[model samples]
Target: MLIDTHCHLDDPTLLASLPEILAAARGAGVVKYIVPGVAPEGWDGIARLAEEWDGVCPAFGLHPMFAGLYDEILLTRLRSFAGRAVAIGEIGLDYLAEVPRERQQAAFRGQLRLAVEAGLPVMIHCRRAFQDLLAILREEHVQRVGGVMHAFSGSPEVARECIGLGLYISVAGTVTYRNAVRPLEVVREIPLEHLLLETDAPDMTPEPHRGRGNEPAFLVEIARKVAETKGVTVEEVTAATTRNAVRLFRLS
Candidate 1:
């Protein structure tokens, strides 16, 4: 079975065809999904989806792209989902975003603290700000409750650094792209034990399916590419990644 470690299933576009999407995913052996929150307004909808679906796991957090929306009110709401959430995330620093770095750091740190307090892992998002992100993660002592670096497209060296801090590097459908030099290198260099698979559905669609709306069903393409890159059987890649996901999120 495969677990989509990161998917925006709660997004309205996907939700519009929930039944069909989930059916296709299950058919492809994508048994579980971890849906993360990007904003306060989406949290309730995510919670409801998790409740209604057998394999839908929910994670609550504010994404770095939406850092300006972070505040005490959002934190309090996130805390309420701590007991049920698999991790605290879809949170971290995004230097590309126009939001002030200070505010993004503040939000990321707050959620990290909450993750620590609740004894849960995190799902970190980072881009062009690894220096600051690493510094903040260390300052917050995040090694205590390690998390996954969601949709990681960083170098193998960066992947190693995150692994050193007890974090997992999650690869998305981008690995299937022929032009994806960096991600392909990462897949070849990083051990499968520290890797997780995701579709980042509704985005990051894999080859042959590019320009189409992504879904968990396309995760098979990613697994095929990872196996091809690492010179392992697809079954091995699937089993190892699924095990890593279960262990990291403490999934049943």
Candidate 2:
């Protein structure tokens, strides 16, 4: 069985058709999904989905894109929601966007502390800010509860850094694109034992399916590409990644 380690199933576009989407995912051999929240507003919806679906797990946190929406008041609310979540996540830096770097840094650090305090793993969302993120993680001594780096698009060196901190590197549909040499390279370089697969559904659709709305079902193509890159069978990739997901999230 395959596990989608990072996906936003709570997005309205996808959530509206839950049964069909989940059926398609299961048809593709995707037996489990970890749906990480994008903002405080999305936490409840994600949690509710997890409660309703046997294979879905919830992760709550403020995404970097919505960092400005977070405030001190949300901390208590987050603590309550996180109690039911598998991890604290979809949180980190996004230098690719216009959000002020300092503000994003503050928000990321705050959530990191929250995850540390809650004693939960983090599902990070980093983009073009690996060095800064790594520095902050180091400073915070945030190695206690390492988690997955969602949609990882960094160099093998950066992947090593994250692995050093006990974090897993998740490769998404981006790896299926022919132009995604860097991501593919990282996939080959990182050991399968530390790798996880994701689709980042409703986005990052793999080749031949590009321009179409992505779904968990497309994770098969991502896994196929990873298997090819690593010179392993699809079953091996699926088994290793599923094992990594269960171990990382402490899922049953």
Candidate 3:
């Protein structure tokens, strides 16, 4: 079985098509999922999804693109989740979007602090802000509860750096693309143990299924690509990545 460590099942599209999405995911051997919240408004939805599904884990945090929605009140509420939240995430810096840099940094640090205080791992979303992301993670001492760099598409050097800081690099469906030069290179350089698989569904649908809404079920194709990149069997990639997720989130 495989675990999709990152998915946005709470999104309207995925939520509206829940039954079909999950059925296809199960058909692909994706037995578990981790859905990350984008803002306070959606936290409850993520929680409800986990409650209704057998193996769905939820995380609460403010996305960089939506940093404007963050406030002290929100941080306090997120902190209250503690053990109930699998991790404090999909949080991190996103320079690609039009949000203010300062607000993103503040929210990222606040959520990172929340994760440390809660003693839970993190699920990070980074885009075009590698150095800034690493700086904050280092200053915050994320080693306490190592997190995963969701949708990681960086060089092998950057991957090694994050690993050194006690973070796992999660590969998404982009790895299945023929022109995915950077992600494929990173996967080849990093060991399977440090890797986690995700579909980042409702967004990056793998090739052959491109133009369609991404879903957890597409995880098998991503895993197959990971196996090919690492020169190993898909079974081995599945076992290692699942163990990494279970250990990182302390999943039952």
Question: On a 0 to 1 TM-score scale, where does candidate 1 land against the true structure?
Answer: 0.99
Pairs that clash in candidate 1: none
Model 2, clash count?
0
Model 1 regions more than 4 Å off: none
Report the number of the highest-lDDT candidate.
1
Q: Which candidate leads the pack in TM-score?
A: 1
Tell me which of candidates 1 and 2 scores higher on TM-score.
1
Q: lDDT tens digits, residues 1-252, model 2?
A: 999988889888898998999999999889899999888877888888998997999999888898887778876788898788889988999999788888899888988899988889999988999999999988776789888899998999999999999899999988878778899889989999999999998899998799888999999999999999999999999989999999988988
Each candidate's number of clashing pairs is 0, 0, 1
Cα-based lDDT for every prediction: 0.94, 0.90, 0.91
lDDT of 1 by residue, 109-179 (tens): 99999999999999999999998999899999899999999999789999999999999999998898878
RMSD of each: 0.7, 0.9, 0.9
What is residue 196's positional error in candidate 2, in angstroms?
Answer: 0.4
Arrange candidates by lDDT, descending: 1, 3, 2
